[model samples]
Target: MCLLLGVLVGRAVPWMQGWRTRAAHRAAEQKLDALYSQYDDIYHRWDE
Candidate 1:
């Protein structure tokens, strides 16, 4: 039915958007953590 398809599509769009947003957030967090670790390593080396 057209109505059923419409409903399914409506629900799917938001779900897909949310999934993409979460994935992006996770990637950004990982990048930030990597950067922090690299900075920390450099700082430690400088201290020695």
Candidate 2:
């Protein structure tokens, strides 16, 4: 029973880590996109 539990945990841990990594990467990309959008808006307004 313990061995089974350990094996399950071993698999789960890597999967969870990968999921967290992807989420963080996605969040960073979103933040960068928002920043660029804001910058573009400000630039266009200034140009007018």
Candidate 3:
């Protein structure tokens, strides 16, 4: 299954630390940006 494969990939490589760490940071930043944009849209009115 893909889930198992992903888990194996995530854990099986010691040489993937920098790439994996950057990937995680990029993911977190994207999530944070999405949440902030959502909150901004919810709170601000364009034509009020």
Candidate 4:
């Protein structure tokens, strides 16, 4: 029983950490996209 519990914990920990990494990456991508959109808008306005 102890061995089984240990194995489950070992596997679950990394899987949970993977979600943190994914969330960080997603947030960064969104920030970059927003910045790019703002830049495009400014450039278009300047062109007009």
Candidate 5:
């Protein structure tokens, strides 16, 4: 499943690299999981 998904994503990689695609990706990522913010907060909390 992961391998097939990788191939599928590979086919879309060019589109994913475009600015419009990136914006949509960002929006979808944020909606799916706030991993970016949580990751930053984890590091900052460790620093503190």
Candidate 6:
């Protein structure tokens, strides 16, 4: 029983880490996109 539990945990830990990494990366990309959009809006308004 202990061995089985250990194996299950070993598999889950890496998967959970990968999921967290992807989530963080996606969040960062969204933030960068929003900043760029804001910059573009300001630039266009200034041009007018």
Best candidate according to TM-score: 4
Off by over 4 Å in 6: none
lDDT of 2 by residue, 1-48 (tens): 999999999999999999999999999999999999999999999999
**Model 2 segments beyond 4 Å from truth?**
none
- Return whichever of 2 and 4 wins on TM-score: 4
Off by more than 4 A, model 5: 1-27, 31-33
CA RMSD, predictions in order: 1.2, 1.6, 9.3, 0.9, 12.1, 1.5
TM-score of 4: 0.86
TM-score of each predicted structure versus truth: 0.80, 0.72, 0.59, 0.86, 0.35, 0.74
* Tens-place lDDT digits, model 4, residues 1-48: 999999999999999999999999999999999999999999999999
Clashes of each: 0, 0, 0, 0, 0, 0
How much lDDT does each candidate structure score?
A: 1.00, 1.00, 0.87, 0.99, 0.85, 1.00
**Superposed Cα deviation of residue 22, candidate 2 (Å):** 1.0
Q: What would you estimate as the lDDT of candidate 1?
A: 1.00
What tens-digit string does per-residue lDDT give for candidate 6 at 1-48?
999999999999999999999999999999999999999999999999
Total colliding residue pairs, candidate 2: 0
Runs in model 1 deviating more than 4 A are none
Cα lDDT of candidate 5 equals 0.85
Q: Write the per-residue lDDT of candidate 3 for residues 1-48, one digit (tens) a residue.
A: 999999898787865887799899999999999999998887787635
What ranking of all candidate models by TM-score puts the best one first?
A: 4, 1, 6, 2, 3, 5
- For residue 3, model 3's alpha carbon misses the true position, in angstroms, by 36
Per-residue C-alpha lDDT of model 5 across residues 1-48, encoded as one tens digit per residue: 999999999878777679677799889988667877887899999999
